[model samples]
Target: MATPNYGYEKRQKELAKKKKKEDKAREKAARKLNPSSPGLAQGDPETDVASLEHDAPTVPELPTKDG
Candidate 1:
């Protein structure tokens, strides 16, 4: 079996963490540049506007014959 290199493993972990932090910063900057970019909203008007106006559906009444 090969011996473990504790120092090398620790450095590798630190490098990974640094890369992750840099990536998040870049993403935040990109979002700042495009504030109005199309994305998921709380609610979309075209698909949800009608449903919002109405509640429960009503059943049609049957007609009765008069004597």
Candidate 2:
């Protein structure tokens, strides 16, 4: 009878799949618990700049001379 050297390989793949499923479930539960989380939402910096267009000045960068 031949011994199975690839048994651990199969066990590792099964463990990886289980871990991924668990992580996804945890994320789903957290989002359900907190729908208005700041990290999950995107911020619009452009809107803020647009509101302050007259007060905000555009500065042009001067070319640097290499000695």
Candidate 3:
């Protein structure tokens, strides 16, 4: 019969929590540094422009009399 290592498991859980917290802090710092990041849920100017261009309707050429 193997005994459960509760101490090791607790330490591992703590390390995971710490790592998650650190990663979240780093992400938040990055977002703060770059306000235009897509993660911020704000409209990006370049994205807006691209969407507008993509959605723009194309004009059809008229047939000329010589055609």
Candidate 4:
């Protein structure tokens, strides 16, 4: 059998990591350029929930036996 090519494997891993980092940087830059983008707002769960709650119709509370 042939010997394993360690150098090639290492280079492949390094390239993958670099690509991931660059992609993340590019996404961050895009987000910065479009501050009002809907994608950005959806990132915050709390704010999204709050907005939904505000827009949702209110329901009347039922009376309890204690009252």
- lDDT per model, in order? 0.71, 0.71, 0.77, 0.79
Q: How many residue pairs collide in each prediction? A: 0, 0, 0, 0
Query: Which candidate wins on TM-score?
Result: 3
TM-score of each: 0.52, 0.48, 0.57, 0.56
Instruction: Give the TM-score (vs. native) of candidate 1.
Output: 0.52
TM-score-sorted candidate list, best first? 3, 4, 1, 2
What is residue 11's positional error in candidate 1, in angstroms?
0.5
Give RMSD to native, each candidate. 11.2, 8.7, 10.1, 7.7
Q: Pick the candidate with the highest lDDT.
A: 4
Report the C-alpha lDDT of model 4 over 1-67, residue by residue, as the tens digit.
Answer: 9999999999999999999999999998886676567765764755454566667677999999999
Question: How many residue pairs in model 2 have overlapping backbones?
Answer: 0
Candidate 2, residue 33: how far the Cα is off, in Å: 0.3
Which regions of candidate 4 deviate over 4 angstroms? 39-67
Candidate 3 — what's its lDDT? 0.77
Residue-wise C-alpha lDDT for candidate 1, range 1-67, written one tens digit per residue: 9999999999999999999999999987886566454652325554343455674667898887962
lDDT of 4 at 42: 65
